[model samples]
Target: MKTALCIGGTRFVGRHTVEELLAHDYDVTTFTRGIHDDPFADRAGVSHIPGDRTDRDALESAAAEVAPSVVIDFCAYHPREVKTATEVFVDARYVYVSSGSAYARPDVPMRENGTPIHDCTPEQATDDSAESYGPRKAEGDRAVAVAAVEGVEAMAVRPMLVYGPHDYTERFAYWVGRVAEYDRVLVPGDGGSLLHRSYVEDVARALRIVAEEGEPGEAYNVADRNAFSLSESLELVADALDTEVDVVGASERELAAVGLEPADFPLYTPRPMLVSTEKLASLGWESTPKADAVAATATAHVENGRDGAENGPARKDEEKVLEAMEETSA
Candidate 1:
């Protein structure tokens, strides 16, 4: 059996990637920091190696012990981080989980191009500023390309707006909670904004596909096939929950009064975001239906009890927005 090593495999997308790898009958070994509990480690074909990835000796020791055939890195954020992982897995096929925000003008369905370089530097990439996330990711992506280990090469998987079970961001769950708890939901502007998102399952499936069959040294954008508008996708969620929500298009001013910003609302892109998956598809990549994915996400959110301050605006805050709208209409 082929052994696969996943760094940071106990959390959201990382956890799902491990699940995908295990489902494929690969002997899966997860490397983590021992900060959380993982139910997967209890399974028949899974193992856990807990330690700080920043610790080079520990990382090298574990790599030698596992001797993995494939390594999927889910936690490296900059070139320094990438260098550390690549040094350890120089002989194995690699998958570096990169971000779509690495593009400067990710306002569109970005293809694998270099125009978005908005000036990439080692300094900008190494910093931890909110502004540095994308640039830092770009630097990391570059590192993966240059570090191309001998024999089997690495494939960079860039995913956009990942959401599903174990989503600590609570972006998608916020909408799921709104549909479940409130009849009148407040949305940004007209809520016709379009954006791209990669479901956790979809991303995991693509990662496995690339690991097994993808071309080396090639970067692929792993995103959903369709560009969905906020209102349109929410309708699918509403249908899933058997609930009708009177969607209100609140101006930014109204949201600001309620302490909400444009970014605070999930899926708040002003334009269409249609990321190209042609490269990934050429390697046999497929996706779950967008409608089905959205419905399943809503169901998972409600069942997982993700409704709280962590998800997004609290119910009380939403209720206050409703009150304001009601007062305006009255």
Candidate 2:
């Protein structure tokens, strides 16, 4: 069986990535702290390796044992962490799960080459952090590009606003949930803020492609080329829920006033950062139609009791995190 090591494979895109890997018949071993309950920690064809990414010694010992054919790092925030992981697993192909946010100031219809600088703010990336999130992540991408991993091909995939089942971020789901209840949906900033969306499954599929067919040292934008504005996304959700919701625009400043961070939105936009996926498409990767993705998201929201505002499927662990966030803010 083909062996794959998925670091940080228990949530969001990572969870979907693991499921996709397993479906493809890869012998999957997931490395996480198992801090909370994992739905698949006990499944057949998968092994759970408990370790901390920040702890190099623990990671190295684990990597030595797995000796996987491919390594996908899904939760790497610091470039150094990636360097450590790559250095230890010198024989495995590395697929770095990066963010479109790494493109600090991308031009319209963002291409991988257009991200000019590592321009994340100090607040976002912090000191001891050389690059901001975008730039820092880009730097990590570059490190993996020339990785010393013998016979190990490395590639980076930058996905934007990944959403689907099991999303606790509730960023996209918030809009879906809110609109399912309130007739007026408030949008933070001009509705025209162009952005990209990728269904979680599409992102998982792209990662598999990178493992199977991606070119070494290549950075591909894994985005839905025909991205929608924040307004359009809201409209899609409204339609999916069979509900009519008014779109009320609020400035970023206004959002901050309410103590809500704009970055928290699933349809993220500090500025216009639309992406072009012609490169990935040429590689035969395509995102799900936005309408279908939206509908699925809406369906999940409805099943979770979002339409009624007091009900929805509750995954206990995710609910704890959401509750903590709300409590802290309160």
Candidate 3:
């Protein structure tokens, strides 16, 4: 059986990737700092190596132990980390998880080669703030390219706004929670906001496919085939919950009247964020159906008791905004 090593497999996409690898009949080993619980501690054909990824020696030790055929990296935030990992796993197939944020332009459909990559300054590469995240990821993609030039089997997969079960980011869960708990859900900007999303399972599958069949030095974008508007997404959640909700759309003026901005709402993008998955589709990748994916996510959200209270404005704040909108309409 082929052996696969994951750099950050204890949570979110990493966790799903491990399960995906196992389903494909690969022996999986996850290298994490051992702070979080390991869901695969007892799973068959899986192992764990506890160490900090930033530590070169730790990574080298794991490399020597597993000799993985493919290495999927999920936690390399800094460009230097990606550079170091490419060197350490020089002999293995390396796939770095990049983000759509790496695209410098706000093109309607960001293409892998068509869009310019955000340039990363030395300062930005090391900075951990949200502002620098795209630059750092763009630089990491450059690192993968460099490794490929040196004959390493390195590739990058860029996913946009991944959501599903065990999503620690809780961005999508915030919406799911609102649909599940409230009768009148507040949606920003006429509820026509579009933010492309990739289901966690599909992303995990993309990682494996890119490692096995993708060309070195190329980056592939991963997202659901059909992008959903913010209002449609809420409707999907409501369907998943076997209930109905009145999706209340609040205009920018309405939101501002309550001392709120559209940005305050989670996943509220003033401009539509989209990326083309055609390249990945060329490699034989297919996304999960939107309705089915939302169902699974809703089920998991309830099971995990993830209210997503921290992701967006509090319920009281939302109520205030809703009340203000009602008064103006009256």
* lDDT for each residue of candidate 2 in 153-232, tens digit (9 for 90 to 100): 77888887677877876767766876776676555566777767788989999998888888877777787657778788
Please, what is the whole-model Cα lDDT of each candidate in the order they appear? 0.81, 0.75, 0.94
lDDT of 3 at 214: 92
Q: Give the TM-scores of the predictions, in the order they appear.
A: 0.92, 0.81, 0.98
Question: Tens digit of lDDT per residue, candidate 1, span 125-151?
Answer: 678787888887777777777776444
Off by over 4 Å in 2: 119-131, 148-151, 188-190, 249-270, 305-330
Per TM-score, the best of the predicted structures is: 3
Taking the tens digit of each residue's C-alpha lDDT, what string does model 3 give over 1-330? 999999999899999999999999999999999999999999999999999999999999999999999999999999999999999999899999999999999898999999999999999988989999999999999999999999999999999999999998888889989998999999887999999999999999999999999999999999999999989999999999999999998777877776778898888898989999999999999999999999999889988988687888778878988888778779
Give all candidate RMSDs, comma-separated.
Answer: 2.1, 7.5, 1.0
The full ranking of all candidates by TM-score, starting with the best, is: 3, 1, 2
Worst 10 residues of 3 by lDDT: 251-260
Q: Pick the lDDT winner.
A: 3
